[model samples]
Target: MKHTYAPIGLYSLCKPLLFRIPPEKAHKLSLRALGLAGSLPPARYVLKRFFSPDTQSLSLFGHTFINRIGMAAGYDKNAQALDGLEGMGFGHIEVGTITPKPQKGNPNPRVHRLPQESALVNRLGFPNDGLDIIAKRIESYCNRRNKRYSGPRPILGINIGKNKTTANAQAYLDYKECFTRLKDVADYITINVSSPNTPNLRALQSEEELEKILTPILDIRQKSASHVPILVKLSPNLEHNTRTGMIQKLVEWSVDGVILSNTTKTSHPWEGGKSGAPLHDATLSLIQETRSRFPNLVIIASGGIGLDGDLQTFIEAGADLIQIWTALVYRGPYLLRRL
Candidate 1:
């Protein structure tokens, strides 16, 4: 045994200390630690041995993923910790729900924890360092690529959104600006129309509105030599009929993939969009429905997943890959090991 007890014991010892701090502050501190650890190979070796999956190969979109699990978006909105994160063992990491221009997202006290539900509620509003800054960082990583940073520089997936001030009618242009700057760096792109905190952001999910926004991006993507994959992040709050309609449209547009959900605006006793336990049933339904509608489209599932058994539910519902955020917060870095 490669000292199995050590990592979990360390996490148990440190858990109370981390939980004592404010959730957002603790999150920032965790990312900083990861960034520092990125430069220490011996530390990474120990961490990887303890947490990384035994089998590290998955095929999707004709590309091989170093593993099946990925760190969902929101963990790295600014692409600041890619090297360190890769060392820790995520098959891929999606960075940003970044906008065309830099933005200060919704004011804090924006994230909340619901221990009762084993969940989280966040209205972080896509705070990011903008596409220009993010693109440069990704290109820099690509230039200095190493074996530790496996599988196409760990599949840089850019998630785009409209600026807080942008009108709903012009949201497509905002996505265009981000795509134009980021296409070269992004292995795949996710058009985010599901964030609950941004005003009218979810309206773009409507079929007529979605076509207006997606049509141009698809045209641009098709014309490009890179032919980078494109995906859409959807909301789980929609009625069954609407969700089915959206899947049909995604197939018709030939989108490269679909992220089954973003967080939802369901109000529990805690404020913000509910994620983790409460989202489990609804998210599964969305995945099951979408999979039935588009058997061939790659589906990346997220929302409300906590335990090892939850992974099987998502897989059975037709998710090609699964993502976890709240569980990572509550379960510590040893999450992948448990899975």
Candidate 2:
């Protein structure tokens, strides 16, 4: 059996101090500290030995993953804290919903915490550093690791999106550009068609629009990076038929898998895309549904997962992997160690 680390209760203790500040700023501060910690020789050495991630490898999509828990895309939108994230013990880190260009996203107060519900509402959109810079940053990182590393490489998944200003018909090009530009660095790539904050983005999930985005990428795979597996991230709010239709298209396109959610747009009491605890049951159901309909399709469940019970439920419900974001906020860094 794999040895589990003890919770340090660091985030539990510091959260009050962190939460006092705005959510966005607190996130920045945490990212910076994580980067500093990841860069430190002592911190990295100690963490590497302490956690010693179990060699629980999963062979899928032509790659072997040492562990199933991964840090989802949104948290490290710009890929700045990867070293720190790696130090925190995630076996894989999916970075970005990056666009072809840098976007300012929605204005402040975007990330709202609902402590009572254990959720976060955000309309931050895809506010990333754009293709040129991020692609360069990761390409260099991949090159360095490739040159020096020997052990299994953490699965690096790049999630790509179109610029908010980019119109529908042209969005395919944006995704293709990012995929082509970062192909060498990405162990796998995700097509993000479900961010609620991006105007008409979910429309891309529809059969007509989804084909435009997915078809071209596969068209170029043979002449391009043929082996990099591709997956799609779907929205939790999708209707049953819409979900089934999307999966059918993925099967046609030879897409590798699906990440069962990106937050949900709710009403009455909630606003924006609601993530964390509130999204748990819905995500698991989607995973079960998608798995039943398409047995071979790879499913990575994302949403309200934050505990061992939650993880077990997802894994047993046919989830190949489960990704978490909000629980880390509610449960803290110790959550990663515990997993």
Candidate 3:
């Protein structure tokens, strides 16, 4: 595997052009380009070179990451861009809040950019190609590329959730459907109950509700004889005691890890789930609190971390791993280089 490396200066030159397009549209183009480059050694090399590849690999969730930085779930909702994300040298990549069936998510204008705050508000109610489709892609990724790689495999996590129409009474079925499909292929699994876009979805964050959802998925793992790490994604808005209770339950339940947060639901001069620079301080506080309570629990910190220094700050605050979303969109490809 050899590469025709791109000069380090190319990405900065392309930043203005990417920003000119709609943010979502630009995101799509970047995914496609990275997807193509991922299959070709030279192109992948060039792509990684532009980000100034980090040589360190850290172990977590029974797998080793090429670095601590990871791309969060919403970035590649359908599992289509793992190769490309890996090409860019993300230590890990999470795809999907995949549901039992495909959905249109929220209506258009569902995602908006706030350049002034380096933040974004998205009401994309888990729009994805669903479990079956995403599962197949993961299966293909594992069989085709993951098997042959002798080097460190970029950690892969499948993030799962219920559909918008599914009643809360039966949400566990949607989660089970996705978990059963993805468990075999995923290095880790994330139960996403924090997104503000779906009605009543946050209710699942309660300890009783969360246990109802996670216990069954844990059962599936037991039944299948798998030890894949299972993690719960949390909302940043939970009251401190409520959040601590949830972490205690996760520890008691013997779950593998917890994602510090999904996007926030606060009214911060924007609508929908607020992410990016605005989430930095709140996320750190939450991670610190969570780590204090459950010292051994794997904490994947995510939220308002846009600058490179934020990664170190979170890591020092007891986070084992970190994820990024709005930052890539606002800071362009160069941002990850600093990490």
Largest lDDT belongs to which candidate?
3
Please, what is the whole-model Cα lDDT of each candidate in the order they appear? 0.80, 0.82, 0.83
Q: Which pairs in model 2 have colliding backbones?
A: none
Q: Model 2 over residues 19-118: C-alpha lDDT tens digits?
A: 7998889888888877777778688666666654455778889888878888998998888877777766677899998898999998887888877777
Residue pair clashes in candidate 3: 3-42
Off by over 4 Å in 2: 1-8, 49-53, 267-270
Against the true structure, candidate 3 reaches a TM-score of 0.93
Tens-place lDDT per residue, model 3, 41-64, is 888788677873565788776788
List, residue by residue over 1-339, the lDDT tens digit for candidate 1.
Answer: 010111244577786788788888988998888877765888767667877764557777756777767888898888877777877778878988899888988898888877656677888888888878888988887666654443343566788999999999999899988888888788788899999989889989988988988888888888889888888999888777887788788888888888989888866664467777777777787888778878898999998765766666788989988887888776778777666
* The 10-residue segment with the lowest total lDDT in model 2: 1-10
Residue 276 deviation, candidate 3, in Å?
0.4
Clashing pairs in 1: 276-304
TM-score, cand. 1: 0.93
